[model samples]
Target: MLITDDDEGDRRLVARALKEGHLSCECVEATSIEEAIFACSEYAFDCAIIDYRLPGRDGLDGIASLHQRFPYMSIIMATGQGDANVATEAMKLGASDYIAKAQITGGSIRRIIENALEKAAMRRKLALQQEELENFAAVLVHDLKAPITSVRAFAVLMEHSVGAEITDKDKLIGQCRRVANAARRMDDLIDTVREYTRADGQLLSGPVEMDRVIEDTLSNLHQMLLLRGARVTHGRLPFVLGNASQLAQLLQNLVGNGIKYCEAAIPTVHVEANPDENGAWVFAVKDNGIGISEGYYQQVFQPFKRLHDKSKYEGTGLGLATCKKIVERHGGRIWCASADNQGTTFFFELPACPAIA
Candidate 1:
């Protein structure tokens, strides 16, 4: 916490009150708003208390400046008695709460500080959710445009061919197939969006044997593997605490991408896991395929962010994003390492399952 009051006596009084309240907080003092802003830049303080009267600027100015720079920090304005209007203005300037200097007490200050912190946390969470919703909406609209247009164009062509007496059977049939494929692509995109949304939900947690996850994933991709002549091999894997179905999806996506993006005659992918120094299981899915550039390492994990043209590689581009969400939900992280023309390896770490009693 930070206290900004030009009056040394008032600063000491607030500090003393906090001490008397037995609050577990480290207080930093600043004589002016400038000093307070400097202190905040140096460290991350959860809350700040600013006196209404300052050297050159009032607390409202400080509140506005601090709030603009650090929206996540909780700010409280301290005003003199009968400063109700000032308090209201302070709040409009982004002050979380206001306290009258004369009313400052151990109990009152503690309650006010607690409320401010809670409000700050709630504000941050709401902001993040709003950003996510906006991003999802943008991605959906942008990606659906091409497929939707294709469906409409092909449907029109098929309709005209059916009306023509001299229509070629093969041409009409090809148009109908094009329409069906476009519709299928649209359906696939919607399904991918649904899966991505579900990845953000509560995980149904349990011990998941990674070997079985690989078995199921490979089974799911059996046809793709045979068609591409891809080879997938894995060593013994450890058990992890996560959703079994999501883990399987994660691996399936990685393995499928390895085969889909390869230039090799026979793509090869290997999956393995080992214990890290942090007591987490680090799993790696390595592939021998046309590799990713260093520049696209982070971009690959963003939804609807495609590194290749859809004409060459068909996908909604949400696979790696879904993988990232699944790993994060399991209290882990995922990243990749690759060089151009060299194979890529995706590594994710999840909490190891606890030993049974």
Candidate 2:
């Protein structure tokens, strides 16, 4: 920890309080903003307890400079002055917490430090979640607009054709087909968006049976599976600690990818599970179908990233991304490996759950 104070007596008092509080921390002392900056540059401190009034510069300036250099470091402002405005200004300048030097005691210092650390952790978590939401919204807007525009353009063309003297049966049929296709595209986009939003990382606390999840996912897409003439086989699977619904969604996306991205006349999908070196359950979904290119392996996991044309494959490009989000929420990871026309294999690892006694 870094402690910044110009007064020798005040620094000694704070150190004594910390010792009495049993807060075992390795502290480095700095008397001014420049010293504080130099100390921070040399070492990473968990938290900085800084005096708001220094010899040369305002304490708020120190807080701002430290914040720029160590964005994730927690800082608490300690000032003898009881001015409420000073505390507010210090906080606005990036102080994580504030304390009055007059009120400094072993008990109060301990509580303040604990509370400041907790708040800092919460702030970081919330920021990460907010960033994810923003990215999801941006992708949703960019991807959803294309289908909407297509639907509108098709609708306008149909309206104009109805009023025109072009009575050719083939032209009329083509116009109607275009409108129908556009409407279906819009419907698919809306459905995919709804699914993506539904998987909002709200994982439940329980043991999820992967065997049941896989079976249910296959059942849900039974019609599609049959239409594609795909044969899916699975070995004995394991249970994992996570939400059942989310696990099912993850399996469904992998299975669907296997069935859809096929070059074989009859697609073959194999679902297998094994234990990794870390004892995690590594589930692999292998498909004898058209494979993804090496260059686009990582890109395929990004939202709204379509390696193939929408004309050939019907998807909103959120399937893999949703899989990734769900797995991560369950404290797991999902990835794919494939080469062009060599088929594809998707592997996801989840925390292993011991068998119920």
Candidate 3:
């Protein structure tokens, strides 16, 4: 907590009130707005109380400056006289709350501080949600353009050759196939987007059997596995509390990625789980395929983020992003460890189901 008051008496009074209130905080004193800004740069303070009168600038100016720099910090304006105009302007300048000097008792101060902190937390959460929505919009616009453009171009070409006596039948057939493939890509992207959004919905949680999830996942990807000549093996897995379908989708995406990115004649993937020290189930999906570089580990989980060219590997690029959302929804976390040219191991931790009595 920071206390900014040019008057030494007022500063000491605020500190004493905090102590009397039994509020456990490391209070930092600043005599001016400049000092308060400097103190903030030096230490990460959660809340600040600024006197209406300062040396060079008033409390409203200080509130605007500090809010601009650290938008997440909670700020309270303190004034000797309760001027409604000043209070309204301070709020517009991002002051979380306003308090009069007469009400500087331990109880009132504590209540004001708590309310400011809660308001600040809500503002931060809303900011983060807005940022995520913007990113989602940008990804959709950038990724969907390519397939849509391809479909349009191919359709135009086929239309141009519609009435012309086609000398080459194979060429027209190839154009038709291209149009079909582009349409399929667009359909796949839309389906993945739906799955990604659905992961955020309320989970119908239960004791999901890992063995059954893996079995169903493999069955769903049987044709892809056969075509790629990939092998997926797993040990005796454990039961975890999560949504059954989502768990299946999570495993399917990981295993499919392992097979899709491999260059080996016969790709291989292994899934296993063990109990961690915290009694949670730590699961790993190890793959013997072309691996990811250390630097791109974090970026790979972002939506529509890809490391390879579309011609070489085909995907909507939402697989890992969807997996991350699913794991997080289940109150878990997922990450990967790998090196270039070496194999990769993806690890996720989930709560272990209690033993049946």
Candidate 4:
């Protein structure tokens, strides 16, 4: 797992504890926050143990960066000094757990790592179960709504033929149609629930080129690009460590996002990537579409949330939320930068996959 600490003594202590406990954790050492992130490029680990007191960098800021790229990887902060307030801030900044440096040990260290790993496993399992339930509910709703829609259609046809002179026929048909429409909407919601809440299926990992992943993601969204008249361009990107299937889904969500909410005449989405000051990969998907309001920036990631009315747009609202899940699973964080009508940029950073020899 990713291990970062400016304290050489402390780093070794934690490493030995993990080893002695037979945790199978390879301690990748980092003297600074930037170096710690670079270590991610070398290999993708299941968790990250960071020093809350990294001397030069505030522990919380470092955790924020790591959390964005490595959302799925459990991270704990190690600090020698702190009250409840500092510990609270660390967790707010996305730390999975907190450990005081003075408290580091073989036995405690083993337990911490074990606990984090176990928690990750539990979350994945829960997601799978939840997706199965959603899929089942969606199917049930669809079956129930079919007859309602047919009834509404027949009512409309009779009303149209009978006209207003047919007494209560028009009003009765109108009411039936409204009820049918609501049922159809519930059907849509059920489907979105399944789409957004649906399990990510599964992922297969390997050394994949970034350009290839982008191409594949774009290919899947060919229909959206045509409909929205949005064009995307980016420079050559180097290979990063991750599952190609998961990465494709990641890009699909980003591009589909450009099509869904933007009200601009022509939407333009741009993709770019580069090695940061630290060697990790940072990629951005910028769009010249309708920008999201500041207040909704964080809320947009919440499941089943939409900034617009359902009448105005058709979506499961689970798209970006799902994107957030995928990014975190790969040890990355995702956030948006946008202003009214200026468009928005959804950026995420993932550590480059370590080169296999």
Tell me which residue pairs clash in candidate 3: none
- TM, every model: 0.86, 0.83, 0.92, 0.53
CA displacement after TM-score superposition, residue 275 of candidate 1 (Å): 1.0
lDDT of 4 at 221: 85
RMSD in Å for model 3 = 2.2
lDDT of 3 by residue, 1-357 (tens): 999998889988899999888899999999999999999999999999999999888889999999999999999999998999999999999999999998899998889999999999999989987998899889888888888899899888888787676668788899999989988988999999999999989899878889999999999999999999899999999889889999999999999999988888999999999988987899999998899999999999998888999999999889999999999888889999999878899999888887620
Q: List, residue by residue over 1-357, the lDDT tens digit for candidate 4.
A: 777888788888888778777777566788778887788777887888888777677678888998787666778888877568878988888777778777777778878877877876776678776885686466556555765666677677666757755677666667667667767766776665565543355655668798888898888888888888878787787788777777777888887787666887777788888778767788998988789889889988866667887668866566787788778777788999998888889988777878931
> How high is the CA lDDT of each candidate model?
0.91, 0.86, 0.92, 0.77
Model 1, range 93-204, lDDT digits (tens) per residue? 9999998888899998999999999999999999988997899789799889978899889888877777776458888888888888888999999999999989988889
TM-score between candidate 4 and the true structure: 0.53
Best by lDDT: 3
Residue 269 Cα positional deviation in candidate 1, in Å, after optimal superposition: 0.9
Model 1 ranges off by over 4 Å: 12-46, 55-57, 79-92, 97-121
Return the lDDT, model 2, position 285: 94
* Comparison by lDDT, 2 against 4, better one: 2
On a 0 to 100 scale, what is the lDDT of residue 351 in model 4?
A: 71
Error of 2 at 142 (Å): 2.6
